[model samples]
Structures are given as C-alpha cells and as structure tokens.
Target: MTLPVDLETDAARLRAIMAEDLAVRGVLDDPAWRAAVEAVPRHRFAPGFYLPGEERDGLGLTVWQPVTAALDPGRWLAAAYSDTTLITQFDGDEPDWEHPAERHGGAPTSSSTLPSLVVRMWADADVREGHTVLEIGTGTGYSTALACERLGSAGVTSVDVDPYRLERAASSLHGCGYAPTLAVADGVYGYWPEAPFDRIVAACSFRAVPPALVAQTRPGGKILLTLSGWLYGYARVLLTVSGDGTAEGCLLGGTVSFMSARTHAAPAFGNPAHWAAELPGEARDARHGPERITAATEEAFHLRFLVQSAVPGAQLATVGDVVHLVDVVSGSAATLTPDCEGGWRVREGGPVRLWESVERVVDVYEAAGRPGSESFTLSVHHGGQHLRHPRVPCLPLPSPEGRPGRSRTASGRTGHSSSQLARE
Candidate 1:
C-alpha cells in the first residue's frame, strides 16, 4: 500500500517555487504581492481543474479530463501551482473537485486564470495596500484571495453572475481564513452597494467598458478588462475614470481573450445559406477580400479586431469558398466570393451597407498609417465609447451607422450564437 503524503508541506514548497518564477519573469515585482503569492494557497481555491485529454472538440477546445487532489495529489498540486489557466467549469458544467474523470468533451466556461497574468494585471491596475477593490468574475476566487492578502479582506468585494460560483468562492475563501465580500450579481451592472471603488478589475471580457463601472469608480480610479466580440478578437484596456463621469485610455499591446459574460454569450454559428436566401442583397465587385479579416495570421488578427470593433454584432459564416458577414439585428448581410480576375465579388443588403462600411474602416485604418493597438485609444464619454486612433475619424458605433434591432448591443446583451457570431 502507498503511504499518504503531506499535502500542505508540498503546497507551500510549490507556492515558493511559483513565486520565484513570477519574480524572475518580471510578473511579481511588488514585494507585498510576492509575499501574498507565496502565502495564499491557490490549491485551496481550485482543488480540481480540467486538462485536455485524448479527445478534441472542433471549436479549438478539447476533451478535458478532471484532476483533483484527492484522486491524484501530485498531478493536481502541479496543475494548481502552474502558471497556466486551469479550467474549473466545463461548458457551464461544474467540475467534480474531489474525483477523477478520464475524458469529456466541453468548452471552458470558467477557469483559474494564469498566475502570471493575474499578477501582471493586478500590478498593471496598481492595486495598493489601502485600495478598496471590486473584482469582476469571482471564478475560483483565487485572485480574490490574492487581493485579500495584499489589501486585506475588508477592502475586497467580489461579484459573479452564478450563485454557485459565489458559493464555492466564499467557501474556498473562508477555508483560506479570509472573508471578503462575495456577491451573486451580474458584473455588467457593477456592484452598487460598494460603489466608488478605488480599482475595478475584471477576469471576464466585455464588448465595451461597462457604464456602471464608470459611474461606480471614483474619479481618477482605474478599470481594467479585455474587450471582445463575436469575432473573438480581444484587446486589454486600462481606463481611468475621469471627473466628468467618463473614461478613456489606450489599449494594452498584448492579446488577451475571455469567455463572454454569460448574459452576452453567443450560440454556435450555423449555415448562412438560408440567411442569404431570405435576403437577396445587391451584387457588386468588392475592392477588398473578406479573407484578410478572417484569416488566422497575426496580421489578420489585428484586422479582425478592427472589423469586430467596427461591427459589434456581426457574425461570420463560410460556405463553399464564400464568406458571409451577417448583422443579426438590422438584418444586414454580406457575402463575398473570390472572382476569376483575382478580385472579389460581394453582395450586401439591409438597413446597413455592411461591406461598404467595412471597406471604409479598412480605408481609414490604412490612411492612419496602420497604427498598432498601442497607438489606439478607447474613449468612453457622454456621447458613447469608441476605440480608434486619436487623429483619425471616429469608428462610428453601430447605432449611428444603421437602425437598431434586438441584437446584442455594446451596452448589454440581446444575445446571439457563439458558434455563429463568436470566433473560436
């Protein structure tokens, strides 16, 4: 028979090693944070996580196998301490934290984010000793515990849409002997009871900066989150709430992606042939190829972000060498096919001329000399929020460009298909 192992001793050693890696990699320069990183046991928060197994899901996810400390102390402890993301929720289904599962196909619904990233974002948000923070997406509550360590549990308020998530987080946090405020509420609205926070940091991504977050943040305070859309493009932004009840800042250069706010989650995309059959749009030769916006190349990645920025609710569908862009709301749609002459043919219809507007944005992007996201700024003012280069003309929000429908707007989710609308 195998003898039982001392888990706490091993966990402490792993924590020390993880802290050392962060410091050496420049992710944990703050001495206080480093202390917290070493002291807080992430394993207590995320005792089990899913790892990709032999099977694969076509959506770039995979067949995940659950690992828990009770089943395999060594592997579970290793995953808990690693610098990578550990999924705790699988496709909205909770993982069995004390059991082992060999394989199951599912997308990631929630996770313990990468430790390095967690530390980096906290540092970027400039979390300090006296700051009262509002943490969006409690998830595994690991980051919440980290903040509690550095700033004290009294100053931290965490919120999640799922009550079960909050329950687990509260339990795990209590296990760590720290009790920060945990709430079950939609993060989009911002936790009002704890208004005027010194820092509001999000683990989940949003289509735009939450207006409620702007109002609840004290003037000159910071709000950090990743902005993403159905196209699956992402941009990390750090906005400072101004005295004028507005916030604006440049996009952080690195790429960061997150699952949608459940309220904003989209459905799996389906065939566009039926949609095209319903709306026979005007036919014309197109100057630009839609392939440039959908390709997986790095250069195309930037363009994909720009296109998603320009058209918030548009969904992509590819069929038989043709690419389709459909705006679910307004019923606008565009289909593009490569022409025999090395050009592209297009058909677009509805309240908005989808392809025409896309071409215009691409034109403006090129005219601006193709500035990287670092040079681009995100402005959220009384009029509306817009992401664009300062010197360049505004990238018009959807409302002004076309008529509104029931589709998901930047302000909130009317909802759509993640498969159809969201890029993998």
Candidate 2:
C-alpha cells in the first residue's frame, strides 16, 4: 500500500499533534515516550480498519463498514492517529487484506490499540533503558513499534496467537524499520524461548495471571495485565515477581480492558447457563435490590467484581424488574425479581444456589463500607494469581477512560479491549 507524499507530510504533523494531545491529557509525559510517539508513523501499521455503521440486522447487531487507506487516505490517517481503537480483524480472521471486504458484521478479534492507552500502559509498566520486554498480543504492532523506538528491537520480543495478525504486524514493524522478535504463540504460555524477561507486558486480557508467566520472569520482574470474566469486568493490576516465586500488586483505578485471550475466552452458552433442563427455581425473599450489584455507579464494578470472584463463571443480566445471574460453566442460574410488597424475590435453579453466594458477598462488601478497587490487592504464586480485597473472601480473578463517542482503550486485540461487555 503506497501512501502519497502529501499524506506522509500530514502524518508527521498529525503524529506531533497527537503526542501533544496526550501530553495535555497527562498520559504521555516521559520525554523518551513522547519521542517514540512522535517518531512512529501510525498510519503504516493500520492501512484499513472497520467502523460500526448505524445499520442493524434482523438480530439487532450493528453492521460494520470497512475503510481502507487506498480508498480513503484522509479518513484512514485521521483514524489511525486518533484516540480511537481501529478494529483490524473480525472473528479471529476476516477483512482479508488481499481481498478486503466492502462491509461485514461479526466479532472484532484484533485491533490497533488507541495511542493514549498505548503510552499510558508503557509508562505505567515503567519500561526503562536496557529492560528486556515480552509483549503478549502483538495486534497491529503499533505498540511494538513504539517499544522498539524506546528500547531497540533486539531488546523486545512480541508474540500473538493469530498468525494472520502477526504476519501483518511483522510487515508493518519491518516497514517502519523495527525488527523486534515476533512469534506466533498462545499468550497464556508466554513464549518460552525468551525466558527471564525483565518485564512481561500482556497486551491481552486473561482470566488469571498465567502461572507460567510467573515461572518465566526473573525474580523482581513485573507482569502487567487486565483480568476479565464472564460477567465482563476488566481490572488492571501490576505485580512484582518475587525471588520466592510469589508476586503481589494492587488494582490500578480507572476502567480499561482488552479482548479475552483466545485460550481464556468465555464460552458461548445459550440461556446464559449450562443446564440439563430449565427447571422452575425455588423462591425466597430477596433482601437486596439488584441495583446494588449491577448499576453504573462506581461501586457497582466492585460489587460485580466480588460476585465474579465468588461465583466464578456467573454472567449477570436484567429483565424488567428482575436481575438474573447465570453460570454457564456451572449450570447455576438465579433471578432476583421484584415482588408486590416493594421488595425483591429470589428464584434460583441448578446444582448450586447462585444467588445465595452473591447475596452473602454483597453483605460482606457492604459491611466493609463498600470499598471499591483501591482496597483490592492482587497476589500471585506458583499455583496461580488471586485478586482479593482485605475484607472480602478470595476466589480467583480478572482496562480505561472514556473518549468522545468511545468507551474503551485496548492494550492489544484478543476479543474486544477493556473487559466491559460491549453489549452491556
């Protein structure tokens, strides 16, 4: 894809403007990072991408239209450098660059993460001179290029599960004059050939910090990631690997997410639960309102996060005045619906009583003064990682900021960036 000279001139100005915009927004403050942001021509990484169109199909899913640099250089360049995530592939693979599509509708599987987030994460990771880094989820290689610019190509190793994306990312990186070690491998298993990295930065989301990642990193190394669940809560945490094979960290505030790692992606379960038969559930008095756990309030994500920890795979939804919880992996489902007496009634089904556990956790959380993520601490071990709040019970666990007409910042592409459910 040959870009015109005018676009090249425009790209430099546009890149500088973007760097300044991030600086004003306070995401890009480091001089080296600023230089990397300014030096890289972003448009070269994403020659085409998908935009969600207004049209909807019979299933009520929005239609996605494709825009190419070849077809529309102005729109392509503006989008690439803008603080918007560009969807590059659909349903693991599509928008075939060779025979690119006119329009399509499916899940977005890969993307070029927006710039502010790209820099924010790198800054947060504390990437410094001579640090050997391993980046999971290569995506469009835009972030890879930035890392290479900050720390030369030989010091970086980036891997992705999608060969299609890696092929394109490799081309873009090499074309941009970067030769970072790129590989096709599952992110959960961090590429073993390059073990003992100083920093393991997972651009993708994982249900838990892969224990193998802990084993591969040198003692005192850091692992940066986002944890996602079936309920779609994404919490970013950074852990310092210890010499004793343990790690500890805390949740970083503000919402940000990424597509679930293909190895850890949520399964498709019809009716929201894995059930043998839809049996009428046992009814009981519901002491708590559904809004306590599922509202858009700041503490709501915390409450939902607690529920996810206790119940594991439970997915939450609502119908009329009723709030539903379903665990496709467990066949447990519960519905909290309003009754005539200005109170809610709980109906639960399946092998395990789902709502009972949720209610209990809410009681524990509310008693602890409804502490949000600030109180949350993430600790990892040879067995696995645990995200726990001091006052809450432990189970297991799981990105940021809004932009105009945008709601997420992807670290790299796996499912959809930041773990909030797109439909929710």
Candidate 3:
C-alpha cells in the first residue's frame, strides 16, 4: 500500500514559491490577491494522486513522472504552485481512485487552472469586496476559494456539472474553513438561485456565451470568461450586461484551454478509418489557388475565422509548405500541398485539399490582401443571440475582397459548430 504524503512541509514550499513569484511579478502588491494566494493550500484541494512529472514547469515543458504514480506531497506542492494546469479528469471523466492509471489517459477534462491564469482572470473580472459573484466551473474549488476569500463565502456562488467533483470540492473547502453554496449543475445556464450577480466569472471556456448568463446578471454587471476560437489561442472577453440582457466586452489578452462544459462538449467524430476509406481519387487532387492566399494577414485572419465558424470540427495544420484541414465531424481530413511556385494540390484523407471545403478558406484568404487581426470587427446580434465579430454582418460567404459581407441576417442559425470550438 502507498503511504500518505506529508502536507505541512509541502504547503510551506508551495507558499514560498508562490510568494516569491508574486513578489517578482509585482502581483504581491495587491493585498487581497496576495492574501488569497498565501492562504489557499492547493494540495488540500488535490486529493487524488498525480505523478512526479505531471506538473507544469511553466516554461513550455510538461514533465510526466509515472514511476512515482501515487501522489506525493512535495510534487503536489510544486504542481499546486506552478502556473500550469493540473489535469483532473481523463476522457471526459474524473479520476477513479481504485484505478489510478485510468486518470492519465485521454484529454484533460478538468483541472485547477494555473495560478497565474486564475489571478489574471480575477484581475479581468475586477473582483472587489462585498461584490456578489457567480463562478462557473468549480474544478477543485480553488478559484471558488479565491472568490470566497475576496468576496466572503456568502457573496459567492459556484456551479459545476459533476456532482462527484462538487462533493469533493465542498469537503475540501469545508476542511479549509471556507464554505460557499456549491451547485452541481450546468454552468452554461448560470445559477438562477443567485441571480443578478454583481460579477460573473467562468473558469471554464465557452464556444459562445449562453443567453442565460447574460440575463442573470444585473445591468452594469460584468461577465468575464475565456472565449474559445479557432486561432491558436483563446480571447478573454469582459462584457457588461445591458438592461436588455445584452452584454459586450472586448477581448482582453491571450488564451488558455479549458474543458468544454458538458452542455457545450464537442460532439464525437466517427471512426477515423471510415473517413479514410471514403475518398474519391480524382477529387483528392483538387487545385488550391496561390501561395499568397495561405499567408497570414489581418484580412486573411478574418477569412480564416469565417471558415472556422462555418465548418465545425475542422482543424488547420501547416505542414512543409502544405496546409491540412482535419475535419473531426465528417471523419475526412484533407491536405493542400503547395506546388513548387506557390500553387497547390489538394489531397483528400490527407491534411489539406483544394476543392475540399477546407481549401475554399485558403482561396478566400488569397482573395483578401491577408490583413492582420486589427482590421476586423465583431458584432453579436439576434438580440445577443449570436456572436459575429471581425466578420461584418455575420453572413456565410466572403465578399469580393475576402472580407465578411454585410450583417443584418436572420436571427437564429444555432451559431458555430461546437466541435471546432475549444474551452478555456
């Protein structure tokens, strides 16, 4: 049997690391933030075991230590202190204590987000004392603890979908002497029991902001969340609710990946083999227009965004002068191989194919001057029913210059595909 690890020593080291980092980063200047960071013992919230190398090093290196499979206090402390995500689930499921190995497989479904990200989010939300806040995604209850520390337990309400996670987190919070109302329900809907929140923050990422979250907040209340997109990174947006339940916030900075809430989870792509077997030979070598088209430009960025928005489950990859689009839904992955002088050939079943729906995006970009991200505008319409930004008027097809055409289209079309969107 594995022995239990010591918590006190580990907590001290973690405290030292966090304090040092905060001091160096100038985050320690905020008394409230500093106090919360110091007071929270991250290990208490991580009850399940984690391998030695599982922790994030914060320098683009992920060390996986499987030899020491069971949780260790020192390792846990370091992991808790680092600015990296600690995986809490595998294959859309949480860890099963009896089967420790099962915890490591598949994509991480949940985690106590990195400390830096959490702190940054709090900064974005502008959390203040006495403010009533609703926190979405209560993984390990760490962020909820911070909210509690900042706003007091009575002032914060947290919601999550997994009852087991909620129950475990409740115990951890109680053990640490902080108790907030914990609800085991979908966060996308927002907790109506604590409606009219002065501030709303989501630790999880959403493909699109749910109407319910906007409606539940009081006018002038702010909503902070990581908005998932096709780009390599996500945009953290901070919008304020209007009296009419509409909210608009600017994209803050950078991105982070989070598990999609159950309500917004990506649909599973059918068998890969099935997709590989269904390609027509002649259709495979379709023509992709020009080399300048795939080049990144502000205008081209808008075209790319349109393609991503239109096609659900499509992933873009640039390989050795060739661009590939892996369609998760149809199980068809296409590759567009650029010919010698910037022209290209489409390869179905590969990453990019010209005639395929994926290459159409490249054609659109080539048509555009390849503008940067600054030139576009994003607008949400349908009574705040949809998010259409960067691309004008939210139309499906591109204009002659590869820019999104006019808006004012009909209200509802179910928005973008959930599969292509990632949570942060």
Better of 2 and 3 by lDDT: 2
Per-residue lDDT of candidate 3, residues 219-318 (tens digit): 9988887654333224456878788756665555343556666655555445544543565554334554433334454334334444554454555565
State, as a TM-score between 0 and 1, how close model 3 is to the true structure: 0.74
**Once all C-alphas are superposed, what RMSD does model 3 give against the true structure?**
7.5
* Candidate of highest lDDT: 1
- The model with the greatest TM-score is 2
Clashes of each: 11, 13, 26
Misplaced by over 4 Å in model 2 are: 54-59, 98-105, 272-277, 317-323, 338-344, 398-424
lDDT of candidate 1 over 1-424, digit per residue (tens): 1124577788889999999999998889899999999999888888777777765667644677778766777998888898989888866877555555654556678889989998888998988989999999999899999999999999999999988888988998897789898899999899999888999999998777778899999999999988777667777899999999999888887767787777666544456886677666457898778866777666566777777766666778777788888876555678888888888888876656577767866777788787788887888888766766665665533332122224453435443211112211
Better of 2 and 3 by TM-score: 2
TM-score versus the correct structure, for each prediction: 0.86, 0.87, 0.74
Q: lDDT of candidate 2?
A: 0.77
Worst 10 residues of 3 by lDDT: 395-404
Model 1 misplaced regions, further than 4 Å: 1-5, 54-61, 97-105, 267-270, 279-286, 319-322, 338-345, 396-424
Shift of residue 211 alpha carbon in model 3, Å? 0.5
TM for candidate 1 is 0.86
Give Cα-based local distance difference scores for all models. Answer: 0.78, 0.77, 0.61
